[model samples]
Target: MPVSRRDFLKMAGLGLVGSGLPATPLKQIARNVTTDNAASMLYDATKCVGCRACQVACKQRSGLPAEPDAQGLYETPRDLSANTWTMIKLAKENSEISFVKNQCMHCLEPACVSVCPVVALEKLESGPVIYHPERCIGCRYCMAACPFGIPKSQWEENLPLIQKCDFCADRLAKGEAPACGEACPTGALIYGTRGEMLGKAHARLASDKNYIQDVYGESEVGGTSMLYIAGVGFDALGFPRLKDDPLTAITWPYMKAVPAVIAVMASLSTAIYFRTHRDKGKQNGEEASDGSKD
Candidate 1:
């Protein structure tokens, strides 16, 4: 689908390429971490200095590889890829500039989880999106279906699989904050229950003029575990103004037609196979008859 210029700006701001939804959105986050609304992270752009410390920490903690912008800057990655699960992006609006941290939105009803044929992606009860590599079939459907285009494939592997931030699932399992959240020196990234994160974000917006009036991830696509507060308007910082509907709702109706198409194609192929064999048999019989006459 051709996206509006505004949506385009949102993707560009994240430094993401060829991914994301049409701005349709998430639902109410779970109140309790173990239930559905588990831990969440709130990113405040006004306090971010673009130090890239969180990015490094995530790489270290998760054992994720780095791209190092091979042909460009020494350490900065152009975007999240198979190697980099988290990234820090910079956007400018005139004299004002903000640094945005980009990762999986971890949607309440994630489209990636919904479309996966093998159930490789799961929305964890503790507020993380977890992936199982063994279940992946290399379909790349998740890559196409993700609203944020967060999932990436490891092209270099003999048997590559999809990859994205799982909000540091292993760390969360041990009751530890995500490595990125812990590494944030300026308190730009804070980790807690989703409710706590939302409350803090709203409180900041209520008390501070430096923050934009809205929390970016609170209502965009049902609701995501990750939330954001920026001094500049979200659009100015390359964030999409998404609706509150889950991205799955926007896709399921069209997806239902796929099975019907496959059935039709299967029937057509069977008819063609029988017809070709019949024609070959008739041709053979005619040649035999001609040989007898000779």
Candidate 2:
């Protein structure tokens, strides 16, 4: 009474059937939210004066603590972190200098939202990619999936949570602008509908001779809620050069195969366990029979 190759195949098939993977492949699932009236932000790099008003406003609105330097004299963070949601980075190319505003791009088809196993990250129809701490399993997949490297984990805590800009979804719901945009004294940061922002970005590109020809986020990674226009090349301003295709194209195939692979492995493991124990039991019975004859 040994298990045959046919029996093994049957077991594998049953495991696949019981895995409960969705009927629709992950690639087929809708990734892009309707963005016609979605909340969006536009940053004009030429207008930014490196005042850091937006950074301060962001911290105040989010109730985040300040990060002090080695001397503990002042809060000057070099990059985004759990406490620092956004920051102004100064990039210098020869004598010319440009202040780059760095934060979550909040892509139309967010890779972070796509990769989260627990649905802890969600892309709202209004354009913010918000995080749900209660639903989070602290997987940190969203941090890795983001092309902009926006999400930061609170590593100090026993149970750390991911943190990043949510485009001020609460403010958007209240029909108010984001704190960062509202705090900009130079009118560098503009908040409006995605359509309106795109229009303004395009208009500036056409009207201003000094501004770069390209709109940074209009088509990058299938577009983003946050857009930028700069006087110098974006590369000089420390912007990542990304393709127009959505990141979901790259992640979906691997995600889709996970369940099937798990099922096959489970079935093989089960079959091995049963076969090993069955052989041991049969050998024990044979020894008992021989003893009776003696």
Best candidate (score: lDDT): 2
Model 1 lDDT per residue over 1-294, tens place: 345544554665575643333332223443444523578899999999999899999889877766766685587678889878888999988888889999998887788999899999998777788999988999999999887889999999999999899899898899888999999999999999888888899899999877779988777777888899998778877766676666776566446657766887999999998887888977788779778754
Q: What is the lDDT of residue 146 in candidate 1?
A: 80
lDDT of each: 0.82, 0.86
Candidate 1 stretches greater than 4 Å from native: 1-37, 69-73, 251-294
Backbone clash tally for model 2? 0
lDDT of 2 by residue, 92-167 (tens): 8777889999999989889999999999999998889999999999988888888889999999999999999988
Q: Which ten residues in a row have the lowest lDDT in candidate 1?
A: 18-27
> How many angstroms is residue 104 displaced in model 2 relative to the true structure, after the best TM-score fit?
0.7
Question: How big is the positional error of residue 49 in model 1, measured in Å on the Cα after superposition?
Answer: 1.0
Clashing residue pairs in candidate 2, if any? none
